[model samples]
Target: MGSVTVYGPPISTAVSRVLACLLEKDVDFKLVNVDMAKGQHKSPDYLKLQVLSLPSPLLLHHRTPTPSLLVLMSLILTAYADRGNKNLLGRNGGGPAERAQVEQWLEAESQSFNPPSSALVFQLAFAPRMGLPQDPAAVELNQAKLAKVLDVYERRLGESRFLARDEFSLADLAHLPNAHYICSAGKDDMLASRKNVARWWEEISTRPSWKKVVDMYSAPPA
Candidate 1:
């Protein structure tokens, strides 16, 4: 626990994901805000890390990918996992196979939940920041996508409280940011209407760690 720095914009779901894990584990870490608002990700120093066999974002389809949050998740889960705290994986039968299955579902959640949800954020916040057309259609389309994702969650919740097993696991923690963001963005009724999902979210969102992140986002950015 020397110092773990997350490089990203001020209000990114990826950063918030890491913050959720840190808060859950009760780890004291520092937040090194790499202001993407000022385009620091394109700097020479940052670029050199990739060119010199460092963990740089390789150009993808001629466009670089965004800052990765998986790295942060890796760090947190690795640190937190232990023989005594094995419940985080899956108790009563958290064998290797179970962990692998848990990982798969969590990855699926990340892929499926993030795209449209983040797009919604772009419409509501980023597009306007960059002087883009945050049109009604764009917003509605992204929201529609999110509504579908929530339906999936609602179905899953009918079976269990959390996503990965009967109890909370990395998958549930991984989803909190996106789900919470959706709820906070005036989509609360949509989430609340899904009885099981609403109850599930209410329970997870109340966790001490998640509460810290929620507090930061309680006030909408002006």
Candidate 2:
């Protein structure tokens, strides 16, 4: 098998998500930095791999490029689960029911959690860094939206240690990157204010695999 190469900087939420997944699955891969600031993502070469201009990570393996972030992570998780890394999918070898539950939470994260969270991350964190003006209305709207989502998560997490069940799965992993930025945006209260949600966040965000991803973000460029 050829080496797996991920194109995008670690700061990108989608890229970090894939990086953390690869770490959790114990997969070795190379990182090829894409400076979105420099419009590198718009380069002809980068666009060739991701024509959709999706702000997601691009994965190159065996000369094949996977452009969709969800597809890339799904492929990694399913491939590893089939190889005995069952926890990536769900608890107890991820039976059909458990797998279904995992997919449910994954959908919730994508549909419910991601929209508001990503908007807030962009408005509060990225805007300031990129010299773009933050939109106050957007921030307020997304804050309310994310809070509502977290309230539901607090209730669900009270019953289950993870989104799907008592075991950590891709469902929880899927939220790590966005939630990390939400906290970084100085809106940690959205997560920290809810007890069960806070506890869940602590557990998942502190996982050694995720910590490694954070370290990668801070690592000096080669």
| Native-referenced Cα lDDT, model 1 | 0.66
Q: Candidate 2 — which residues are off by over 4 angstroms? A: 82-85
Alpha-carbon shift of residue 132 in model 2 (angstroms): 1.1
Q: Which ten residues in a row have the lowest lDDT in candidate 2?
A: 77-86
Q: With candidate 2 superimposed using the best TM-score fit, by how many Å does residue 42's alpha carbon deviate from the native?
A: 1.5
Model 1 lDDT, residue 77, Cα: 57
Candidate 2 local lDDT, 81-196, one digit each (tens): 55434686776568899989999999999999999998998988788989999999999998999899999999999999999999998899999988998897788888888999
Query: In order, what lDDT does every prediction score?
Result: 0.66, 0.87
Show the colliding residue pairs in model 2. Answer: none
Candidate 1 residue 63 Cα shift, in angstroms, is 27
Q: Model 1: which ten-residue window has the lowest total lDDT?
A: 56-65
Determine the C-alpha RMSD for candidate 1 after optimal superposition of all C-alphas.
5.9
